[model samples]
Target: MFRLVGSSVQLDIQDPKPEFHDLFWVINRENNVVQYDNKRKNMMYYSDYGGRVEFNEETYSLTLKNLQKTDSGLYEVRASGDEVRVVAEYRLSVLDPEEAPVLTHQLSRDTCNITLTCRGHDLSINSSCYKETCEEKEVTSPGGVILSLSVSGSTIICNHSNPVSWKTDVLEMKELERLCADEGEGEDKVN
Candidate 1:
């Protein structure tokens, strides 16, 4: 499961047999997250999960809040009776939201060269635009963030995205066209 930072996630027991299992324990790898004692109707949150964890008595589910990047790990649910048995397992990944991509353009003659840089991902896309159309490229960063540059009419669109979130930036090219047009007119008048 992929989640954004500061978000919340609920881990529920899959195919729960409420009658067979009364004691439920949620574990994040080797660390104990929370445990519910159905017989005594008591819930305990261990380690640093005191107020960040919530346990539902009826569904034997655990909800974690205010997630951080360090919380990405494998989680397991163990139900104990005569012997401890694993009921559900989950691999969680927490990522910070993507920032808007930076779109920069340089105009010369009839073509406008553009570069799109994704913040934090260290990925960039360089393309050329002619008149109202632009070249498009899609690049994937080393950390799995995706950077894309596309053209919509006279607007250049740059998008930065990951599994958890996405952001975009736009550059309008109408001014570039006007500048180039004026430069062309000035050359004609001088000739």
Candidate 2:
């Protein structure tokens, strides 16, 4: 059984046996009364029993939310009957939010081609660049890398192996059209 002490608590339960269905229940530690039913797969709001919960089967776990100060004590579970019983005790504690990763991209243009580069913050080495039909390539270092594609319409992708980060960018045909127009204008001026 997993003890949840504060808000936004979620539980992931895995069942081992295909035949028997897993069951869970919560008991109020202070009052010694059943508060939740895991078999029904339901959720309870802010109640007296915050983290006091248990699972009936070893294969499954339970998650409780909106934990309060009163929610502290022992939790028990019965897998089969009087033969198998699992017990766990927990104390509720509050926590703060977590941070997310940031992504950035850079594009450079020259007369012949254009290069698009993608970089991730504090990532691992072994990164690679690829096109739609090609396989993954390893990037030598963790820093930014460039992916070169024709000025024509094509898709390019950059991937990192260790931290598992990837970015995709497309080369627009408009760049080729502009290049051709500039060449035509230059030829006309020379004529």
Candidate 3:
């Protein structure tokens, strides 16, 4: 699961058996986060997780608050008893919110050809529009950020997104037509 920094997430242990004894939430199989003692009917939050972690006694679930990038890792729930058993595990990734996409356009008077560029994060996409038709392109980066452009009627939309956040910019096709119309008026003067 992907989360934005400073956000909170709930880690649920599905189908928890009542027969299990003590439950431990460990990070990356090394760092002990929280321990729930079924016999004692209490929970212990370790290290910096104190006050920022909540344990549900009834559901045997965990809720972590104020997530940070360093908190991204594999989390496991283990039942400690005569025979240690792994109950559930989850992979969490914390990422920063994506910025709004930038849109730029170029038009030629001769052919009235238009090219619109949308850029966000490390990716960029270009869309070409002529008359009432537009062509779209999309791109993705290794970090999971996506940039895309699409057309709906007279509106062109550029979107930039990650798992946690999304930003978009829109342009009206009529505005482009008006600009091209004005450029056509100056064509004879330039020649």
Best by lDDT: 3
Cα-based TM-score, every candidate: 0.85, 0.28, 0.92
lDDT of 3: 0.87
| Model 3 weakest 10-residue run by lDDT | 13-22
Runs off by more than 4 Å, candidate 2: 1-59, 63-111, 123-153, 158-169, 173-191
Give per-residue CA lDDT, model 2, range 70-120, as digits (tens). Answer: 444444432333343334333333322212322222222323332233343
Which prediction has the highest TM-score against the true structure? Answer: 3
User: What TM-score does candidate 2 reach?
Assistant: 0.28
TM-score leaderboard ranking: 3, 1, 2
Clashes of each: 0, 5, 0
Candidate 1 local lDDT, 56-167, one digit each (tens):
8778788999998988888888887777778888998999999877877666653344333333357887777666667788989777899998777777778899999999
Clashing pairs in 3: none
After superposition of all CA atoms, the RMSD between model 2 and the true structure is 10.9
* Local error of candidate 1 at residue 12 (angstroms): 1.2
What are the lDDT scores of the predictions, listed in order? 0.76, 0.37, 0.87
lDDT of 3 by residue, 107-146 (tens): 8658677889998877888778776677888888988888
Candidate 1 regions with alpha-carbon error over 4 angstroms: 18-28, 109-121
As for lDDT, the candidate ahead, 1 or 3, is: 3
